[model samples]
Target chain A: MSAKEYRFRLFVAGNEPNSRLAEQNLRALCQEYLPDRYDIEVVDVLTDFEAALDSNVMIAPTVVMEAPRSVTLFGTLANKAAVISALAL
Target chain B: MVENQLPNIRKCHTRIEGLDQILQGGLPTGRTTLMIGGPGSGKSLFGLEFLYRSALAGEPGIFISFEERADSLKNNAATLGWQLAPMEQAGKLFLLEGRIDPRAVITGDFGIQSFFAILDHKLKAMGAKRVVIDALDVLMRLINDSRREQDELVALHQWLAERDVTALLTVKAPREGQLERNYDFLDYLADCVIQLDNRMLGQLSTRRLRVVKYRGSGFGSNEYPFVIGSPGITLLPISEVGLSHQALGDRVSTGLTALDDLIGGGFRRASSVLITGGTGTGKTTLCSVMAQMACARNEKVLYISFEESEAALVSAMRSSGTDLSSTLALGQLRLLSAMPEAMGAEQHLVRTLVLIKQMQPSFVIIESASACKRMGTEQAAFEYLMRLINTCKEMGITVVTTNQTAGLHNLDEISGIGISSLIDTVIQLRLLEENAFLRRKLLVMKSRGSSHSHSVHDFAITDQGVVILQKAD
Candidate 1:
C-alpha cells in the first residue's frame, strides 16, 4: 500500500522434504506474483533455534509475510490461491 | 511406626528442602505428579523450580510449555534468580514451547500423538531425567473430545513412567464445586496429586499446599503453608510433626531478689515464663528486670518489643536507674521493635525463627502479648505463640512474655487466648485498693516442678526498675 518492497520470511528445519518444498513453492509464488518487487529470506531453525522463538513460528515450514499487515501460513505453502488470498499478494 | 525398619522405596529428592521433608524424603521417582492450583497460586513456579533444581543436581531436564513461549518462560524464571538460558544452551535443560491458540485448534478426531512424539524427541535428545509440562489444560482443551483426552493423558503418564523420568504436570483448578471434566480425569491418572491454594482471609493472603494422593508412599497429609519468595517456593510444615523438646533442670534468676524468693528460687532454665497484669501494674517492668539479669550474666538476650520502640524502652529503663544501654553496647542484648499491625502472624513466626537461629540467644522476651493479639484471630495468635515457645524450648532458650489483663479487680484473669497451661510459670500482678490509695502486688499463680510461696508481696516501680517491698513469708 505504501509502495514499499514486499518482504517474506520462510522458516525451515534444514533440508527436510517439507522445508525444501515450502521454500520452492514460496519462491515460485513470489516470482509469479511480485516479480522484482519482493524479497525472500530463508531461515534454518535447526541452526538458530532461538530464531524460531523470535519469529513466533510454532511449526516448521512456516511462511511469514512481514510487510503490510503481517500474515502467517503453516505447512508447505503449495496452495497458491490460499497463500495469495491470505497474504493479499 | 519405627523409622529404621521402614521399607525402602526409591525417591527422587525434590531438591526443595522443606518440601522434601514434608514428602518424607522426596516424591516417588519415575511417576507423574499433577500440581493443580488456581491462578497466581504458584503452580508454574513450583513446576519450574523442580525441573531447575533437578537440572542443577546433575540431572538434565526438559520444560515443555503449552501456555507460555520459551522467551517468556525464560524471563519469568529470571525473576526468580534462575539462569535458565545458560542451562538450555548447555544441554542440561531444554525448553520446548508448544503453545497453540484455542480458536485456531481444529479438533476433528485429532489426538496428541504428534505432541507426544515431539516431547519424546526432545527428552531423548537431551537424556533429561526430569520433565515439566506447564499448563496441561491448554493441550487438554485442544483434544476437545473426552475419549481422546483420556487416552492422551493416560498415554503421556505411562510414557513418562516408562522412561523413568519424574514428570510434573501443572493444571489450573476450577472454582469450588465446578470441577472441569478433564481435571477429574487427570486426578485419577496422575500417580501423585498436589493441590496449591491461595486463600484470602480478609486482607492478607496465605499460600498452602496439600498432597491429596501419593501412591505407594507415606507423606505428611497436612496442608503446608508455602511462600513463593526470593529463591523459590518454601513450605512451612509447622504442625505436621510432634513436639520432642528435652527439659532442663538448671534455674535462672528473675532479677528481683524478693520476687525470686517467692517463686522458690528463680525460673527453670529453658522454661516459658508468663507475666500477666492489668494496665499500670508494671508487667513490662518485671520482664525488663528479668532480661537485665540475663544480660548481666553475659548471655545474649533477644527482646521483641511490639508496643514500644527500642529508643523509648532504653530511655524509660535509663530513667529507672537501669543501664540497659551498656548491655546493648556490649552485644549481650538485641532489641527488635515491630508493630503487630505491620505483619501477619506467619511472617512474625518466620522472622522470629530466623533471628533465633542466627542469634542463638539464651533468652527471648516478647515485651507485650496484647500486640500479638492484633495480628490475627485469637486462634492464630495462640498457635503462633505455642510454636514460638516450642521452638525456643527445643533449643534450651528461656522464653518470657508479658500479657495485659482486663481490669485491676480480676487478679486471676489469664488474658490473650488463655494459654496459662502452656507456660511453665505464671505470675499475676494486680493493683490492690488500700486506704484510698492503689498499691501494686505480685502473686505467684503456677510454678511447674517447684513449690513456691503463695503469699502476695507489694510490687513497686522505682529508680531500680522493679523493687519488692516485702519478703515472702
Candidate 2:
C-alpha cells in the first residue's frame, strides 16, 4: 500500500512567542512521525492580511488541515493532543 | 429650478403607528442612534429593522456585522419573515462581515483606521442612509486600552456625523453595571439613546425598551414592552383609562349556555377575566369555549397558550364540542404556544403584541399564565401581565387568561393572582367534593364592565365539550 500524504497550513499573524511555540511543537512531531510525506504551509497575516481575513481566522496560532473533502480549523495549535488527534498522524 | 430645491426634511418614520407618536414623528432623519442592551436583549434585530425600513423607504442601507457571519444574519432575518436576501440582491442593502484582531492593535499592525477605511468605502459605494454596526463590544477588544477605545468610538461617531448618515451602533451592557461604560461615549455622540432590557419575572422573561434620551424631541420615558416577530419589532402603548370608563354588557356565553345562564348571561366584552383553578379543573377548556364563542361572532381571537401545543389545543377544543378548526382555518382564531422555560414573560407580552398586530383579534386568551411564573421572578411576571392586560384593554380586546391554583383549599397560594385585581372580571373554577362526589364549580369573582351572576355554576368536560349545569339557586 502507498503512504498517505498530509497537507497542513499553520496560520500565524507574526513570529510571536505563541506562534513560535506552536511551530516548534508541530515540527518536532511531524519530523519524528511522518518525515517523508507531509507538506507544511506557514502563513503570516502581517504580509497576507487579506488571506487571513478571507479564511475567517478569528484566533491566532490556528492550524488548518485542508483535505479534499473538507477543511478543519483547530483554534489553538498549543494543544498537542488535539493537534495530533485532528491530523490523525 | 426654483421649485426643485430640497423640501424640508422630516423625521425618519419608524413605521410603527404608536411609536411615531411617542417619538413625535419618529427618529431624526440622517442621524445616528445608539442602542445598548445586555446580551440577548435583541439589539441586533432592532438595528436590522431600522436598516430594513430604510430599504423599504427607497433608501439603501448597510449592515456591518462584527459578531455574526453573513449567512447567519440572513437566516435570522428570514425567521422574522423579513426577506433580506432580495434587498441585498437589489443593491438596496449591503452586509459586510468584519473581523479585527484584539491582539493586532497591541502589536501595531492594524488599528481603527482599517475599520474606518472599510466603512467609508461601503457607505460611499452603497450611498447608504442607514448603517448598523452590530454590537461594538467585539470591536472594543481591538483596542487594548479602554481610553483609546473610547476615543475611537467618539471619532467614529463624528465621522459618521460628518457624512450625514444615520447609524445605529449597538453595544452589550457590562455584566455588573446596568449600562456599559462605552455607552457613555456613544450616548454623548448619538442623537438618541435607546436601552433594551430583559428581566426575569417569576418564571417569565420580560423584555422592555425605553428611550433613555432623544435629543431635541419629546419622547415617552416609560419602558414599553416590545415584541419581535414577522412584522418585526412593535411597541405596545398602554392607555390609562379611568375607572368610570368601565361599561356593562350582557354575559356572553362561555360557549356553555347553561354556564352563561349561571353567570346571568356570559363573560362581558372588553373585560379582564381570570380563570383560576387547581390543575385539571378544566380552566383551559373554559378558555377555549370563550375564544370559540368570540370567533363565532366574527370577532378576532388570540389564544396565547403557555401549556398545550396548537394541535393539542385544537383537539381539546374539538373534544369540548367547539368547532375551532373552522375559526383557525378562517384566521379568526390565532394560537400562540410558548414554552415557559424558553422565553421570559416580557417576551410573551411582546409576542402577544405581535399577534395582536397581525390578526387584530378582539378576544385574547393566555392559557395558564401561572406557568409563566416558573420562568422568572413573580413580581416581574405580574408587572408584565399587568402591562399586557392594560394594553389589551386600551385596544378594546376582551382578554381572558387561565392561572393554575396550587391547592383547592388554599386560595392564597394562587399563582399570578396579583393580576386578578387588575382584571375587569375574575372567574374562579374549583374542584369541589360534595355528597361524596368530585365536581367542578365556576364562580365569577368580579366583572368590571358588566353585571354578572353572583351564584356559582357547576360544569363538567366530556368528549362532547363543556356541559354547564344549573346554578345552585
Candidate 3:
C-alpha cells in the first residue's frame, strides 16, 4: 500500500532453533515476495538486549514491520500465509 | 512452636509483619518460592510486599507481571502508601509488564530465551537480588503445550539457581475445570512453596496462609490467619505474645473498699478479671468505676465500650457523680466506643490490637462481652477475648471484662464466651427480692491464689456511686 520500501526488524536470542529458522525463512520469504523493495535488520538479543527491551520484544523471533502500517509479530514464521497477511506482504 | 533453622540455608527476611516468624527467618536466599492460590487470594499483594520491603531493606528487586500491568501493580502498592516510582527512580527496583499481546500470530515455536535475555539485562542494570514473576501460569498458558511449559519451568528454575537473585513465582491453582495438567513439578523445582487461602466462615471473611514445603529449612506449616490491613498483610499467628506470660504482679484496688476487702487485698496487677451479671445488674457501672479508679492511681487506662457510645459512657459516668474530665485531660484514660456491629470481627480484633500497641495502657476495660458477640459468632468472640486477655497478660496489663447474662438464675454459667479458666478473678452480681422491693447483691465468686468472702453482700446504686453495705439490713 505504501510507495516507500518495507522496513522489517526481527528480534532474536542468538542461534536458537526457532530464531535461526525464522531468520532463514524471513529472508527467503522476502526474496520470493518483494525482491528489492524491503529492508531487513536482525537483532540478536544475546548481544543487543537493550534494543529488544526498548522495542518491547517479549520472545525470540519477534518481527516488527514498518511498512504499509506498523505492526509486530512473533514466532518461527514457518506459517508463511499468516506472516504474509500479518505483514501485509 | 518455633523451629531452629539449619545453617546451610540463608534467609532473606520478607519484613512482612509476623510473617518472618512463620518462615523461621524468611524464604531461602537465592531459591525459588512458588505461591499457589485462587483468584483474590492475595498472591500478587504478597509478592508486591516482598519486593517493596526488599527495596526498603537496601536489597534491589525486580517484578515481572505477566497477568497485570505494571501500572496496576504500582496502583495497588500505592494503596498501601508504598511509592514504587521513587524506588524505580533510584534504580533499586524494576517493574516489567510482560503480558503478551493477545493478537500476536504464532507460526512455529517460542520459548523463554528472549524473556530471560531481557530479564537478565534488566536485573544486571538494576542489580536486583530479588525477583517476582507474578502469574507465571499466564505465560505458561500462552506457550499452551504442556511439554514446553515443563521445559520452560525447569529452564526458569535453573536460571534462578545459577544467578544470585532469589525469585517468587505466583501461580493460579487450577480449579475444577481442569481435568489434567496439575503443576506437581513446581514442588519438585521450587525450594519453597507457600499456599494462600481465602475462605468465608459463614458471614465472616477470613484469609489464611500456610507453608506447604520448605526444603532444607525450618518452617511453620500450620495455617496462620492473616488480615490485609493498612500495612498490606499482617499474619496473626495468635501466638508469640501468648507464649511469654509472667506471674501476676502486685495488688491493685477495685475502687470500692468493700469490694477490695472481699477479694483479699484487691485484684492483682496484670490479672484478668471477669464480671458476669444480668441486664440491670450494673456490669457497665462496675467497669466505669474500675476504669476511673485505675486512672485515679495515675495509671493509663483503655476503656473499650462495645455496648455504649463514648458520649453515652461519659454521660453515664457524669450521672453517676464520678467525673472523668481530669483523667481524660491528663491523658491517663482513653475511652474508645464502637458499635458491636460497626466492623467485622477480624477488623475489630486488629483495631483493638493496634490500640493496645499504641496506648500501651496499664489497664484495659472491655465494657461487655455479650455485645462483642454481635461482631461475629460466639466462637469469634471467644477468640477475640482469648487473644485480648492473653496479650494483656503477656504485657502485664490488667484487663477487666464484663459479660451480660440472660437473668439472675444463670450465675454459674459465666455468660456465653466460656473463657472462665483464663480469668484470674470472677465477680458475680445478682438481683434479689426482699421486703417486696428489688435488691442488688455482689459476691466475689472466685479469686485465684487469694482468700475471698463467700457471703453475698447487699449493694445499693447510690447517687454518689455503688456502695456495698457491709453491715446494713
Candidate 4:
C-alpha cells in the first residue's frame, strides 16, 4: 500500500528573514524525505491574521503536521533533526 | 432604523416576557453578556435561543460554536420548534463551527485572533446584530496560560463592542477548583453575568437562572426557576416587582345557594378559596358544582386535576348531578390532568403558569392539595402552591383549591401544610358518624375581609348537586 498522506501548515509573519528561511527549510525537508506524500500550505499571519488564528497560530515560522497525529514545532525549521522528529517524517 | 432610533438607554429585548420585565427591558445593547453554568445547565440552549429569537425579530445573528457541530445544533433547535435551517439558508443567521480537532492540530501556540477574523467576516456578511460564542471554555482551554485567557476575553469583548453587536458568551464551570476558574475574570469583562445552575433533590432535578450582575442597570438578582421544553426556555418569576393588581367587588355564585349564604354570598372575584376535607367528604363535588356555576355564567374554568384523569373526573361528576360534558364541549371548561411525580416542582409550576396564560380562565380549581406532595418536600410544595395562588390572584382570577385531611373528625388541622394561612377563605368539610349512619358536615372556617357563618350545617350530595340542609340564619 502507498504511504499515508501527510498534511502540513506552516505559519509565518510576512516575508521576514526567519520566515523565508523557515519556508526554504520546510520545502527542502519535504522534497527530500516525503516527496509525493506530503503537502505544505503557507499562511502569512501579517496578511491573513484571521487564518492564523483558525489553526491557533501564535508564534511565527511555526510548522504544523496534520497526519497520523498532530505535532507542533515553534521557530524556524532550520533544525532539521528536530523538525523530522516532531513531524514524524 | 428602529434599532438606531432606540432610546439612548439602549436595550436588547430577551423576548422572554417575565425575564425582560425582570431585566427592566432587556440586556444592555451591543455588549457582551457572560453566561456561566455547569454541565446540563442549558447554557448553550440559552445562548441559541437568544440568537434565534433575535433573528426572528429581524436582527440577524451568528452562533460561533467551539464545541458542538453546526448540524447537531440545528437538530437540537428543531426539536424546540425553531427551524434554524431556513434562517441559515435565507442568510438571516449564520453558524460558525470553530472546533479544531485536537488530533489534527499540530500547533500548540495559537490565539483567538483567527477565530475573531472569521467572526468579523461572518458578522459583516450576515449583518448580524447578535452573536453567541458557545462553550467559550473550550476556546479558553486552547491557551494554557490564565493571562492569555483573560486577554483573549478582553479582546473579544472589545471586538464585539466595536461592531455594535449584542453578544452572549457561554462557559462551563470547572468541576473542581471553581474559585480558581476564570469566571471572575469573565465576570469583570462582561456587561452582564448570568449563572445557570442545575441541581438535584433526591429524584427531582431543577434548573434555575440567576443574574449575577448587570452593569449600570437595576435587575432582579433572585434565582429564577426555568425549564427547557416544547416552546423553549421559560423562567418562572414567582412575584412581580409590586402588587397593584386591581380587585373587583363583584361576587360570583358557589352553585349552592345555602352554601353561598354560609360564606356570605359566594366568593369575591380574584379571591383564593380553599376547601379542606377528609376523604369522601365531597370536596371535589363542591369544586365541580362551583366550576359548573362559573361555566354557566359564560366564564371559563380551568380544572387542574392531579388525582384523577379527565374522563374519570367528568364521569364521576356526571354521576353526582353535574354535567361537565356540555361545558367541556363549549370550550368554557378545560381540564389538565398531570401526574405531578413525573416532573420537578418547577417544571410543573412553569407548565401550569403557561397553561393559565394561554387559557385565561376566570376560575382555576386545583382539585387536590395532595398533588403538591409530588414536589418532594412539604416546604417546596407549599412554596409552589403559594406562587400558583399569587399568580392567579394577580390576574384577577378566582382560585379554588382542595386539601384532603387525614381522619373523619380531625378538623383541627386544615391541610397540615401551613398553606391555609395564605388562603383567603377556608371551607371545612368533615364526615361525622351519627345515629349509626355517616353524615357530612360543612362549615366556613374562615373568610378574610368578610364575615362567615359560624354554625355547622348538614351537607349532602343529592340528585341536584351539593345542598346545605340548614337554612340561612
DockQ of all candidates, in order? 0.14, 0.05, 0.63, 0.22
lDDT string for model 4 (B109-215, tens) is 44444465566677877888789889988867766679878887788888889999888899987676556457788888898888889988657888888888888
Interface RMSD of 4: 5.6
User: Any runs in candidate 3 off by more than 4 Å, and if so which?
Assistant: A1-9, A24-42, A64-72, A81-89, B1-7, B177-182, B240-242, B339-344, B408-412, B433-436, B471-473
Candidate 1, CAPRI quality class derived from DockQ: incorrect
TM-score of chain A as modeled in candidate 4: 0.88
- How well does candidate 3 score on lDDT at residue A17? 89
In model 1, residue pairs whose N, Cα or C atoms come closer than 3 Å (at least 3 residues apart or on different chains), thus clashing, are none
Worst 10 residues of 4 chain B by lDDT: B104-113
The sequence of per-residue lDDT tens digits that candidate 1 reaches over residues B206-285 is 77899998776777889887766556777778676677666865887898778888888988888888888878788777
Shift of residue B113 alpha carbon in model 1, Å: 7.2
The C-alpha RMSD in Å for every predicted model, in order, reads 4.8, 9.3, 3.0, 4.3
- The runs of at least 3 residues in candidate 4 whose Cα sits more than 4 Å from the true structure, single-residue gaps closed, are A1-32, A43-88, B1-9, B105-108, B178-181, B408-412, B471-473
**TM-score between candidate 1 chain A and the true chain A:** 0.90
User: Pick by lDDT: which candidate is best?
Assistant: 3
Once fitted onto the true fold, the runs of candidate 1 whose alpha carbons sit more than 4 angstroms away are A1-67, A72-89, B1-8, B64-127, B329-331, B408-415, B471-473
Q: After best superposition, candidate 3 residue B468: deviation in angstroms?
A: 2.3
* Model 4 C-alpha lDDT per residue in residues A1-89, reported as the tens digit of each score: 23459887887777777677878888899899988888788888776866775665545666777675677765566568767777766
2 or 4, greater by TM-score:
4
